[model samples]
Target chain A: SQQGEEDPQALSIQEGENATMNCSYKTSINNLQWYRQNSGRGLVHLILIRSNEREKHSGRLRVTLDTSKKSSSLLITASRAADTASYFCARSPSGNTPLVFGKGTRLSVIA
Target chain B: DVKVTQSSRYLVKRTGEKVFLECVQDMDHENMFWYRQDPGLGLRLIYFSYDVKMKEKGDIPEGYSVSREKKERFSLILESASTNQTSMYLCASSLLGGTNEKLFFGSGTQLSVL
Candidate 1:
């Protein structure tokens, strides 16, 4: 079974607008990371928020984690056409186990 | 800068042919992983190595095998390629045993099994 499931599987937005994607997980996690993938390419690390941290920011990207709800949300502000890509949320379990990822939210930012 | 490289950017092979996908990381990370990405399926971990010559099976390791001869390289092998195996294969490496360690990914190899 998939540990994390992202909502709004596909989203379309105009450039310069803000896009928010949500992710819900089933188990407790030590940390959660977000990654971005361009078409036909590998994933690029975005940001990571640990269970102890409630929110984090990097550039135009903001990430929030609520351990009580086992959920997280990523907000990309002032989205650009270059931001059009698939974003994935991956969870790392409490130990040395590998990270598990959600299907992802495909965001399209039209110019 | 950390760098991870795959053996090929694209490959085509016939059914029943043995295939090998190689991954090398220049960052000296101890953990290496192999994942297959498909449309709507995200990324599925096929195999992972925590150290040289040590391997573990992941969720979708049914028809795949892995070899980690050294710390910097991990190889994924398909015993016999099948048409269904066509997909983008990605390799990643991370530091050993850090809760917040981030994965460094390769550009990926788009394998087409005919």
Candidate 2:
């Protein structure tokens, strides 16, 4: 039940354009994390945003958390063909629980 | 970098066969998890262990079991493999009880149940 929904199940963008994905949860969370998975590969941790923090940035990635709306968004700046991958948002509901992930947003960066 | 290694990158087994997927972490993480990823369904946690000999059921743990007899090793066992059980299995480890800690995942094993 702690699982969230990722908006825009799939997206297509140009190589130099930006891409954004959203995740909305049904319950309060301690922290939210974004992960990227290449085709047929395991996920790579991108960034983590705590409930108290409104925004966090790491290199080309920016993550924003809106606790009031129980939603979070991940934005990738200047996407590349290599950036074509599925992105998932995971939430740690409580200290004792493991992270629950969303279905993921599949992004296609055309070169 | 933390290394969580799943024993096999790909596995094939017949229905009703006993299967064991092994995972080892070199980072001395206190928590380990087993998850199966499926299309449209995302990643579903099957089991997790916080300590040696300690196991907890996740969202979908019916057909899978796990063991953590050693601090660095975690294993997922399938009593009898089924066709529906065919999926990519991911192993991950993280620090002890910290919401801020990030999970490091293995390359994953794609299991094919015939």
Top-DockQ structure, candidate number = 2
What DockQ do you compute for every candidate structure? 0.69, 0.70
Quantify how close model 1 is to the true structure by its C-alpha RMSD in Å. Answer: 1.0
lDDT for model 2: 0.93
Per-residue lDDT tens digits for candidate 2, residues A49-107, read 98899999999999999999989999999999999999999998866788999999999
Q: What TM-score does candidate 1 get on C-alpha atoms?
A: 0.97
Clashing pairs in model 2, backbone N/Cα/C closer than 3 A: none
Model 2, TM vs. native = 0.98
What ranges in model 1 sit over 4 Å off?
B98-100
Question: Each prediction's Cα RMSD?
Answer: 1.0, 0.9
DockQ of 2: 0.70
In candidate 2, stretches whose alpha carbon ends up further than 4 angstroms from where it belongs are B98-100
Query: What is the C-alpha lDDT profile of model 1 across B1-114, one tens digit per residue?
Result: 889999999999999999999999999998999999998888999999888999999989988999999999999999999999999999999986653588999999999999
